[model samples]
Target chain A: MSTPENWTPQERQLHDALHRSAERVQPGPDGLARIRRRTAVVPMWRRPVVLGLAGATALAAAVIVGGVIALNDGDDDAPVASQTSTSPAPSPSDTTAQTAPPTTPPAETTPPAQSLTVPVYYVADSGDGLRLVREFHAIETSLTPIAAAVNEMLTAPPADPDYRSLWAPGVEVTAADLADGAIVVDLSAPPTAGEDPDLAAQQLVYTATAAAASAGQDGSLPVRITVGGQDPSEPIGRTDPLEVRQLVQLNDPAEGATLPSPVTVTGEAAVYEANVLWELRRDGEVVDSGNTTAEECCTFSPFSLELDLEPGAYQIVVSESDESGGEGRPPMSDSRTFTVE
Target chain B: MVQDRTGSEADDAITDLYAAHYVRLVRLATLLLGNEAVAEEVVQDAFVALHSRWRRLREPAAAVAYLRTSVVHGSRSVQRRRGVAARHPDEPPGHAPSAEQVAVGGAAADAVVEALRGLPHRQREALVLRYYGGLSEAEIASAMKISNGAVKSHASRGLAGLREAMADWS
Candidate 1:
């Protein structure tokens, strides 16, 4: 019920004056140039290989939570196509078709390929009422094409570390499709990170979308992100992914577990935010990747690497940095002993 | 299905996004900060954030909205960090207003400046975007994230407040 008609010309003039003043002072070229100068592009290859889903296999040496459904489906009955060890391509007489390398595996390859499905789960603790949240889901058929995309994202410098810890470490994945397009991800815990239901739902959305893409589908695998199979009010990632690591022990990774691939990283974050980095080493020469925040947070990065480390014993480190680049978190590091043999 | 943006394609998308939006964002930030230098810094921070979370966004089209929202958040953070209050004139004109402004009368401009110093944060933002940026009510709503009703409310209240303060000055 405001009417400028009641006001004097002087009042109107004053209002216009202040508005103009604010506009006149609006930032300009000098300010923009400074911003452009500040944000340098961090080299892509230098980033760490995101854990899990590399070239379709995630690099994260996932610490299988207790709640995991243990569904290593499609992989069980299929003959374990072993590469005739380099030791000997089995005597040619071995019926191995030595080189039938079909330009296209006989059309029969379709049936077996169709069964290549993995049900991966991303579970977040929902607090009291909702013990299990099925964040997202999808069918196996829709995701195969998305592997390349997942591999592309995973290989980038800023690979996802143990983000589940942010939701709740003790929590478990009851079920997971890992496939794109309406992926169904089930978790066995309540959302406790924040009271905002949106925040809880976001954890589900991000996990589902990420997991789905890992399974392989181009465009949006619009995950029907849900809590215990129920729809949410809104999606996640409002500002930052909510800190869900509280319920789970995202702190220390398994002692002897090894990363599935080498990692590289470079990013600038603020002190308060979490800066997660995954390190890969071959023969003691370690490659570090991930962004730690510096002042003002966003910083240009120009570091990178892509290495193929043969299976063997090596040490991988997880480093956390605060806004000031002050190393925080438990600062976990350990030597892992594994052999391709 | 959102196009499966391949790694190289995504990078190009990002570069393209930066090229297209960087300047506009800086301009937006400048208006918000009331200073070009600070505006650039704010806009830069927003872009960096956009880059970091590029993988998480379900739809790449939403990127512009994300950046706009980030600009607001970043400016607020900067304000809090600098302990910025209605900016005070520490020194008069680092450059002279020149001959044309001589007739406008320094006192009237001073009165206007003082009045602006009195408005609250959201009010200032709305008014700046409305008149200065030549943005419509809907545009302001998108930028500030409030409903059109809320924006109209803020603008109305802000302009009224400015008028009252100016009356006090004269």
Candidate 2:
């Protein structure tokens, strides 16, 4: 390699070409000139403080654009599902909406809030076009335990596994909402053995709350959860067949729940399952039994039944029909008494 | 306010630096970038960055080196954008210019760009500083974060390759 000292004709000509190219460049526009002038006028130290805010604005825009693009490009077909927002409220048509037909006796209760308070709503698909619904708050993203537990469920195959984990392990969960008032969570039970079942259950709670919170309700999450057709535990109230009573608005004067709106039941029950027995009972005697079928699987059976009745301490009994045409030994439901004038 | 210096004094210094170095830096950037408009934008961006960090800039003496390095990095960005340019760092074989080719005018510039763009990002920066900005090999090496030997070798190889590809441009 010849040095610059060699005076090669080509080397010198290359140098000349560079100069010609350099000559065509214009100075930066007015904004830059203004920056020049400001830097010219301000004390050197103050320039940073001023520029810092300005720089932040530019950085904020760049970050918004970049982060959006990064998030968008992270997955081609689907954007990152924000683990936060009420994960897609199970619309009215979700197929896993098979709840027992509601036979809950509607007790004279407080009017429902103008808006329903939901902590979380997790809607997922059962690969065979069947959708499963569950909800809760504060789902964890520590990810490992959930992953292992899910793997265990897959391998163990309880009776028959309803949902094959479609999501892979280690995929980052994206968050969307922050309303932790009432959570509808999907299961976090990993398929692996020796997994902390408590943590897994809490994962369900955490995700539901986080999603509900992200969706914008206050953090006091009253949560409900469902796996397959069975309630995770026992009913919040005593009712047959419809055993998942986490959703029952337990109108306990003792519990201090004052409804600003009419009380309504929102969930899924099978058509063949005992039709929803929306009852009206005053001190245990049946006042009115408003009945409706859940009509679909994994759907939101929002029974907005209006019973014109006088009130004083009434119990609402909502129950489900089993495959054997009977209510679950203990039904899924709640009872609340109110003074409706 | 920069505590070390008072208001107007610091202002004058900043103004003087901008006035003196702005155009030359743009030209230097232009040489590496091969696009005049882009060079100016790169220079403006570098200056803005400098302004933001002006307080932490302890030594005015190193500002020129700071500016040159900024231009070099900016030129690399241009190369990334162009995609048509940047290639392997390997040197092309040297070729003598024919008598007919030596007569070409500014058309020779297009060939220069073609050859320089072919050089590695670092080698191109080294050559631009050495020949266009007239910086010494040591100065070029310091600005480029490379050793003097590396600068010498890169410049030599860059020139040799330019001789081959730009032989037709004269």
Candidate 3:
């Protein structure tokens, strides 16, 4: 096969035509500003020094809690579920002293300073399939971002009106460490008994990777899961080591994520001939919409569109075209709800 | 207050890089994703990630490769999400292109884009990286994380498919 250099006149014409088409496309102003907003400097939680300090603080808190347990009259069954912070608090010692213990409950400690807004990924109903709901949990920066994020995922109840967590509340993040750009996350139990373990694994992968990015890892890292000290024989969902999370999904403007007017909806899709449809709706009424082409078709490809809308709630739906070029057959689609401010 | 010179210096370098490469990178993403707005978001996202890891990137020259890799991976994610959106049948149809859009670029340009989109992902990536991106085969391989031989095959197949798709285009 000939390269572009040796291509026939027709091939050369096609190449030129392709170039001209690209030349017509240009990003709107504020592109840089938008990027700056999404990416900020890694916080103190990711730093080794602060993480060490957090460990010491946790140890001290554990000792205080142990003393509180000793003061109680052998009420060893005190529930540990009340303090649902992302960092795992140490359990109280079981050794009982000969002296009589007090009966008063321990006072709540003051919250830590400098909290980080970490995105916790949860599975929510989206049509027939599950779409990710990203909820921000503000945890002390002293807590390691990974531990805190995962801990919250396990303990914090889903706050979104319609969202829910599939991982068992008893599940715990035994340990998490970054290895060779991949995070090895140890869990106390298997994530969930749901029919598709892959989706459950994805929730963890998305949460961990997002936490990593928030902590300053520019690239999204893959996650390897181990349960009760053994790597599961089955595969766990991980960000494509060679690719980003989209693999055939959208990442931007997460569900229930708010945005400004003239919002841009972005995602990935492999459709018939790269023909994808995008529509904007408010309260089930079509506001504005358009059909756009992706970079490639018949395989995973990138798709996006920009819509101008009033400041209000709107749902953006992107779908694949059917055989009649989006005329007749039922099309497959992905949708996200976002507020325009 | 005294500030660290190295930190500020790194920030300045990234600012300069963004000024110089933002448009080019956005266009690259636009070619990969086929939407200007989404392409812009992807490019911006790449730059932000780059900013976060700028120090580790080591050499200034490596920044372009890093951005390219990020854009490619990001596009994959966007496509996957789009595929899910396409599954439900109740949504309204997308708006057709405005008359102004067609008149501005003409039908031939549209056909080229439509035909280019028809190619497989790898082939389209190879062609866009080579023709519009003006990157060498080695660079494309590096950006795509594919072998050099695979790049050549994809480019050849992509050109062949494009030629066939646009057979009737004037």
TM-score of chain B of 2: 0.72
The sequence of per-residue lDDT tens digits that candidate 3 reaches over residues A1-341 is 34766777766766676666666665543343334323433331233322232353454435434433343323221221222122222212211111112211111122144577787877644322454556677776434466568768887765443345667667876555553334545577776575456666777877876786786652244455656445422223343311122212444566677888778778776455677777676654457777888886544567777777788887676766444322222234555678889
- The CA lDDT at B105 in model 1 is 49
- TM-score for each predicted model, relative to the true structure: 0.32, 0.34, 0.39
lDDT of 3 by residue, B3-74 (tens): 112355555566667778888777776666666656665777778788778878757789878988888777
Listed per candidate, the RMSD to the true structure in angstroms reads 23.6, 27.3, 21.0
Ranking by lDDT: 3, 2, 1
lDDT of 3 at A22: 64
- Comparing to the true complex, what docking class would candidate 1 get? incorrect
lDDT of 2 by residue, A138-257 (tens): 223222222222223222222111111222233221111111223332333322322333333443343343333444432234333433212323111111111111222221221112
Q: Residue-wise lDDT of candidate 2 within B66-150, one digit each (tens)?
A: 7777778777776566422321122221123344434544446656766787788777888888877888777888778889999
Number of the top lDDT candidate: 3
The true-versus-predicted C-alpha distance at residue A210 of model 3, in Å, is 35
**Per-candidate local distance difference test:** 0.40, 0.43, 0.59
C-alpha lDDT of residue A154 in model 2 = 28
By DockQ thresholds, what CAPRI class is model 2?
incorrect
Off-target runs (Cα >4 Å) in candidate 2 are A1-6, A28-34, A37-341, B1-10, B77-104
Give me the runs in candidate 1 sitting further than 4 Å from their true place: A1-341, B1-31, B53-64, B82-110, B165-170
Q: Alpha-carbon error at B132 in model 1, in Å? A: 2.2
Docking class of 3: incorrect
Ranking by TM-score: 3, 2, 1
